[model samples]
Target: MLEAIRERYIFNKCQVIILDDDGIITLSDDHLFEVPNAQPIENVHPFFETIRHLFDDKNEEHVFHCIHLEIGDVIGNYNVIFNSGNKEQNPFLVLYDFTENCNYIQTIVQRRNESVIALEFEQIQAQRLQAEQVFKNKLIATISHDLRTPLTSIAGFAELLQKQQGTPQGANYVQLISQSATVIKDILDNLLGLAKLEAGVAETQLKKLHLPELTDYLEAIYAPKMQQKGLQFSLKKSAPKNAFIADTTRILQVIINLVDNAVKFTEKGSIQVFLSVLAEAATEPILQITVIDTGIGFPQEATEKIGSFQRFHSTDVEGSGLGLSIVQGVVKHLQGKLDIQSAPDKGTTVWVEIPIQYAAETATAVQTNSDASITLAPLKIIVADDNDVNILLFQQMLAEQENVQVIAVNDGNTVLDELQKQPVDAVFLDVHMDGLDGITTAKLIKSNKLTKHIPLVAFTATNSAEELDMLQKAGMSLTLGKPFTQQQLLQVLQQISATK
Candidate 1:
């Protein structure tokens, strides 16, 4: 019956062996054992020792799980089944191949592990982005606070110098000082503006603008600078004087930045600015402005370096390398395009095209009265700040005005003590103090009805709008950004007095 069963089921490739009680292969269907003749399984493969127990106690039907086997170059998985109907019947061993099933299972396991690793990598990337954003915010705040304080002092002292009747040379020196401070302030503003735009916090204030008036203003501002450098400056306006809807401040800043670059680089040749409408539609019209300068131009290789903190010009030129970057950002924000054309020793021309909408209302010009004088009533005010220079600046700025009693304190606690001694009309509280922060102090003062009526103005070097909003929510009546002009300071006081 065993021989009949082997003949009926086993094929020519089947590895079947009939073993005797001594575990010797009495007969075999194949020579996979690499034996010169039929031999025992123990001498064939290393995995035989692990399955040797099955041959020892084969009293009844015995079956073993799949085992890996490698014979020379051929690899496979096999299940061993032994049949022992009686001692008289030689126990026959049958090895079944399951290599394909094992390979399929291994592939599934490998794919599953890859999926898990991919998920873990995504989580790590998310965490890294969050950390990066937090670091960026902290860096911006620290830089804004540290840099604005000194700039404020320099500008304040320069303004004080202007108020005095000094010699012509001294007046020139004061003008230089003021101009230097303004340049530094512009650089800082550009850096902060880029940060805000990158963080998606910048918002545009759009208004109706007249192109001819804007070009005229630019000519007025840059002509003097060009004359100082012995360069001819001209503004050509080919665009219509139609009113257009745009961000007045941003557009003006972009123009100023472009003109400033042209004036800075040009030595003797003329700098021409041309404004024209490149394309006109009912809703969206394209406006093009060109700033062409004959100066030490850059090579063709440096053309790609025209954007974002890039200095392709000579190192002798003084700039923060942030002008073009800020310009690019503003153009992108306005849905515009920027192009630069230049060559070595030749001139450079920058073209900016922006899409603008037509506004129905006529654009109004901004009016400024340089000769106007401001008068203030006699009132008591408390100033709390940690910086001594800022305190002195406040005193100097208020010295010209009559009967303005200014009491200066160093910390928030001193501010409270001063308030206790006498009720002041307003309190200038620095947001970041050593002992008590301005927000906590304001909260405490507002909680008490006796001191709540007094206006609390936050004096901070931080340019973050979010920080100002937080201070306002904490009961601060108003906020004064650092490096403030004397006019801005007086304007806040005037508003507070008017409210009273």
Candidate 2:
């Protein structure tokens, strides 16, 4: 019977031992207990003595229950059940290993604790990020609003100075002031654009663009600067004249940024811009643009720094170090590639390739009567703006026009009252104003039968798509961004007048 019990327990990895009535161990499965050679249970295991005492009172059944034992560094959880049948046979002890179950439960608890901690950490980081984004957006809004009014005045007055007759030196000084103001405005615009792009609010609006007209505009704008710097500038176009379907504004921005960099670095060398169609396939037309400048070239190491807000030139040159970054972002948004090649003394060449989408029907350019050719009719216009500087700037710009009366209002309520009192041809509404906002005033004007036909043009510092859409829905006929040039203002006036 003892041999049978020992063999059965040994096969199942359970420790079994038989002890006589005198508390002496008679038999033990040392292998099951992890003992080296065959030894008695009382000699190897420390808990043997304590377990033997439980069978002293053999009158009833004795069960020692669960016991925890440590052998060297290993821990075990064991259950001891004693069998003393009728006092005729020696008592037997059975130890069932519960170590694996205990370890498994412990591992599950540890993993759960780690998961809970990680979840809490992620929640904290999310809340912190949201707060930071809110703060950044507010700062951008405040800066844009505060800087636009002064910038408008500076550029507006400088333009007026350019039109007047003066000495060559005086005219040159005026031109410099105007160019400097424009550069500042461009920097601010780029910063705002970057912010919008980061916030996922800006998008590309593609339209049909005439390449010839674009080249002409660039030549007209930059040729004078090149001449002033004693440098030659040229724009070349290849065959297979094509019109590109693209975001005209962003494309223009990219080209302008590249040209500006070239002009700033070049003193005596020439700058050449080439625009052409690389492949003439109807389905996938590719446009290649290259701007090559023989200027102060940068080291090869600088090529790696062609990303966000990085500059590779001296601090003496005035710039925000954001032009190339903005260009790269715009190119990526348009699904294009940009390549730069240069050496220390040699010039730099920037090549850009973009896919061209051709419209199904070739677009015809809009033809408007020249400003000098258009006969003016006596008209009354309202210029509603809260800022005194903006109002003065608008009045000065309009003073040169013939047979047009401009009335200024500081608030939205006055705008409504002025229209009701007098006959108005058009309303130039500023979107940000006290008492009532521009959108609300426009809605009111459109609702009234008397003034419903009058055209409403929104003047705002922000040209965001959402803002423009809102203005359009509120019955605005046109939208103009702030710090606009004199030519832009005149063009808008002419368009509205022709429609009227």
Candidate 3:
């Protein structure tokens, strides 16, 4: 076979050594090899070097580097050691000049490095995204939970007054109800602002708004807040002022957000609003408005963390830390520049600059249609979860539903027991657990004759397709992932109750 291969490629050469049963060279072609001086093969090296077979150990494969006849400078190399075992009789040693293809080794090494870097980069990217997702979820969770208390109280008071009317204290109760509703409305407004900004729905409505009028209007609006907090507010402008064309409402909102932040951070110090003309280029004119406060400056360590969701005053303030992100968003939508200046224990100064085009302002009222409906009917909801926070959140969200009541319990074990104890309208069950998790719980709930009629809504953390399929197989009525909104809960509950 080797002779045929050599014959086929006439440029190649071959040398073969055949061994006898006792490990002695029986015969060899010895082709193409130059004998420096004719002598026995054993004279050039040890007997093993010219031996018929290489290894004698029992169970392991062995290979070794062996020297072959040196060729010219180009083809000088060693053997690529391989063994076909002693099971066959005609074993021969084959030689190749690996120096001719050294690039293969370098390619292997390069590929190894590339693979490692790819893996590391993948892990880093995944961790970064995971961190972002976790941040988003935690923000939603904190906001949802925080907003629940006040909103529930407002809704409950409203419902109580609505139901138990016609008493002497009705007017006082009505006043209290109005106050609670107002607080809720304020919170809702802030939250809606943040959502709109983050979701990119907050767009610039360009119209001509009188700059002086808008600033005065701001003073009138925040006068009470400033007075209530005992903080002084002053407004000033550069001598040469230029009126601007932009979104009036959005600009007002941005100013209010900044002022509100100032008020929140500054307890007893003064806050000031200043407006100045930045520049006037051929294409556009620029205006700068700054909100300066002397309350409490951001810590040096947390200075950069501002305008992000994880930041809050003392980490204990009543905010979701989304205030500055919204501020940034509002500025971006208006083609403005936002910069912050602060010092520890001093105060914060936020500057917003807007560039307006040559066109004058056009203010047109856009009609908004809001449905006025009071959901006063009580709903019976089953709250299932192992976490106290989640269960409490669900209870609080359902607290204001007019005829609605929540049955809170941990785990699915008592679901059957609770079903037997009361006739609930709907069930909100969490998915992750031990010993009868959501799938098992759902299967048990759906299989039972009496409980099957109740809608089983899954509350989960993982939003994977396989997880959803598994939940679907268990016959759940709906899937509501964790950190869901209060209105979402109400909507889901209403949906099931409406269908029934």
Candidate 4:
């Protein structure tokens, strides 16, 4: 039965190789890892240089899972298994292709994700039943677990590759891979954000926001894309003398989505973003963000359906229109207003207005003597994460900083033991772990006299208000969400150092 299945399903999708005790490939089937045609296959290709290290141990069998191998024009996703049982027997390597299986699984997941999103939209429009809410929560959890974790590994490796010295073509390939991973990460974030919004579990974190700095950051991000497309992009700021208190993350999302939409649709013309404060309103001052784009516009009839998971020109555009929906949701939650105007072949203009109050206290500048430089004290940080990939990513991100050392531990208990031995500046704990979860560990650390002074930062993917409250109550000084960038980590560290 097994033989029949193999012949039917895996006929030409398998590759084989036989190696001597010294890990030299003597025989090859020329499917996945191909042997040279004219050469004796001893070590002809540069690709084999790194791969030969896998067989250095001639006594033990090795298994590598889901390796995407490219040789010449042939590319295959394979699971490689090497058997080097006894010294007397030659080692055999088997490569099994699983590309079709992966595609099938991806198709199924895509269909399921679409269905769940549709159901979530319906729930948001109607009364949100408890069962449906629970189902949505489970979907969110599954997405975070199944997608974001693996994406982190991919992104981490891509970042590492970017730091390595390689040929121009190799560097370009790594850059492309990094960009693709970022796009995937953005899609996942949007899906997760939409799900959380529909479930009414999204948390709003309001803080002081510097408008000028925000616009500068957004322009830096989209300017290159605009240049690449041969489109003119300009950012205009009106007189807003003071910073305002707002949900920084949501506001960033709103503007980014609007600008991203403008960039995506406009091909030959210009896109402009304006930030100004309108004080003539009846109630209070309002912050207005307007985006103007010269692109294909929609009909007046479709204006009302813009925020209901609606898409215009579905065939011409590749988008789910979730960005606009997210923007609308955030505005409504903030008790703000959204206005959109467009005409076919003319242009599109979107205005987002949110009520605001100028900050009570303005930031004061500090002057330091340039000739007398300040020196930072030596610091040690303990990072506790159950996932090895996360720990490695953290270490790599912090590796270049001077006067700082990072010690990695897999669990909370190990963290406590490490703290007992040496003093550290800060401890970053992953909220979920195999044993002694972050909250409990944090409480224990805070309650102890010796370690209570050390700052404890929580790294979590859960953005619910309840989770944030729990972390705060458990004595967490701060919480950073998952899929965070190196700059964010550095900023957190800087803040901790300043506080200390």
Query: 298, model 1: CA deviation in Å?
Result: 2.3
Model 4 earns a TM-score of: 0.56
For candidate 2, write residues 1-500 as lDDT tens digits.
98888667654557777766665567767434654333444565678765555666774455554467776565677766776534577766777777677678779989999999999999999987986676456555544654665677667657666676586756775766776677677778887876775576778776666688889999999999999999999999773655557777788888898888888777778999998766556467766789999988776656555532242222112332455666777776677888888675688898887776775564434444465744446668999999999999888987878777999999889999998799888999999888799999999999999999999999998867888889999999797789887677777777777876
Candidate 4 clash pair list: none
TM-scores of all models? Answer: 0.67, 0.62, 0.47, 0.56
lDDT string for model 1 (1-500, tens) is 98777666655335777776665677776633333235676666766555566656657666766678887676777776777535668777787766777789879989999999999999999988877676456545545654676677677767667766577756775776776677677767877887776776888876766677788788777878888889988898776656677787787777787887777667779899888765455457777889999987766655666543242322222342455656777887887888888776787898888887676554434444354566666678999988899999988988887768999999988888888899898889899888998889898888888999889999987767788789988889798888888987887877777776
lDDT of 4 by residue, 1-500 (tens): 99888766775688887776566677787655566543423364444355566555667777777666666677766777877647687877788988777668779999999999999999876765765566456555544554665577567667667667587755775766666677667767876787687677777766676677788898889899999999999998775565566776788888988888787777789999998876553556677899999987766666555533342222223342456667777777677888888787888898888876655554323232244333445678999999999999899987787877999999999999999999999999999988999999999999999999999999998767787899999999788789888777877777787876
Best by lDDT: 4
Residues 172-283 of candidate 3 have per-residue lDDT tens digits of 6777665666655555566666666666665466766466777778878778788999999897766234445667677777787788778878888799999766555555
lDDT of 3 at 97: 42
Winning candidate number (TM-score): 1
Task: Tell me the whole-model lDDT of each prediction, alpha carbons only.
Answer: 0.74, 0.75, 0.66, 0.75
Q: What is the C-alpha RMSD of each candidate to the true structure, in Å?
A: 13.4, 13.0, 16.7, 29.8
